[model samples]
Target: MDLISSRLLFRPMEERDRRFMRRFLSDGELTRWLPVDYPCPMEQVHLHVDRRLEHWDKHGFGTFVLEEREGEGPVGYCGLEHVTETPFIDLRYGLVQSAQGRGLAFEAAMRVVTYGFHGLQLPRIFGAAMPDNKASVAVLTKVGMRPDKRFDCYGSNLFTASVDRVAFDLKAQPVTHTGIYGAHG
Candidate 1:
């Protein structure tokens, strides 16, 4: 299913998206804040893409490619996934350098988190950001997630945040059905 926000389209990651994923994963500036190593190699990129595809197959929900509503190439991705070695589901998002600082991440996240709660009926969703990545933390908070804890993963210390279905129902600005459609309908 594809999720629609006001300015972006969220389509499920496909095998064909590997090319863009390679490019997205290689951006050192962007990946620096993420848990992955920068200057990602092609093999790792392929593995990452494969895992995302497998995740969807196993869980029925995974990452979504973020594109402009008017048909620009992919700018980034956002979705829910199992946090490795943990029982919690993680809310992850990232954008190309050219697309940063435009509120696109927050928009994509709000929609995805909404879908996690309403569409998938997930009990809760979690997000993790580097302690210094204020922008990412802000996006998560703005989407109604509160600080949950701090943890180490992939050698990086991360600040985790989460929102339960009850908290989301009480705090989130309800995403209107009119603005979201495609596939899942």
Candidate 2:
């Protein structure tokens, strides 16, 4: 299934996306705050994409390749996945350098979070960002997730934020049905 926001398209990750995933994950600037080191190994990149594919197969939903609706190459990815070793589901997103500071992440994330709560009937969805990644934190906050906790993971101290169906419904704008359709929709 694919999710559509006003400016971006969210298509399910596929095996063939390895090439773009490799290049995107290799960008040190874009990935600096993420758990993985910049210029991630090709093997790790393959593993990363494979993990997304595996996640979708195992759990029925995972990250989506983010692209502009106008058909430019993929800019990044956004969606929810189970937090390893924990009983939590986390929302994540990343975008190309050229695509940052343009509200694309927020747009894609807002759509995904809405889907998580209303579409998936998830009780809560969480997000974690490095304490210094104000942009990422801001995006999560804007999506109605409140600060939940702080923890160390993958060599970085992360601040976790969360939103349950009730809080999300209170804070979120009335969802205007748009491009949402298909399996995950």
| TM-scores for all predictions | 0.89, 0.90
lDDT of candidate 2 over 18-108, digit per residue (tens): 9999998887877888865667888889878888999999998999999988868889999999877777888989998888999888888
Residue pairs clashing, model 2: none
Superposed Cα deviation of residue 155, candidate 1 (Å): 6.0
lDDT of 1 by residue, 60-108 (tens): 9999999988767999999999866777888989999888998889888
Clashes of each: 0, 0
Stretches of candidate 1 off by over 4 Å are 150-156, 174-185
Please estimate how well model 1 matches the true structure, expressed as its whole-model Cα lDDT.
Answer: 0.83
> What are the lDDT figures for the candidates, one per model?
0.83, 0.83
Error of 2 at 52 (Å): 0.6
Which RMSD does model 2 reach against the true structure? 2.8
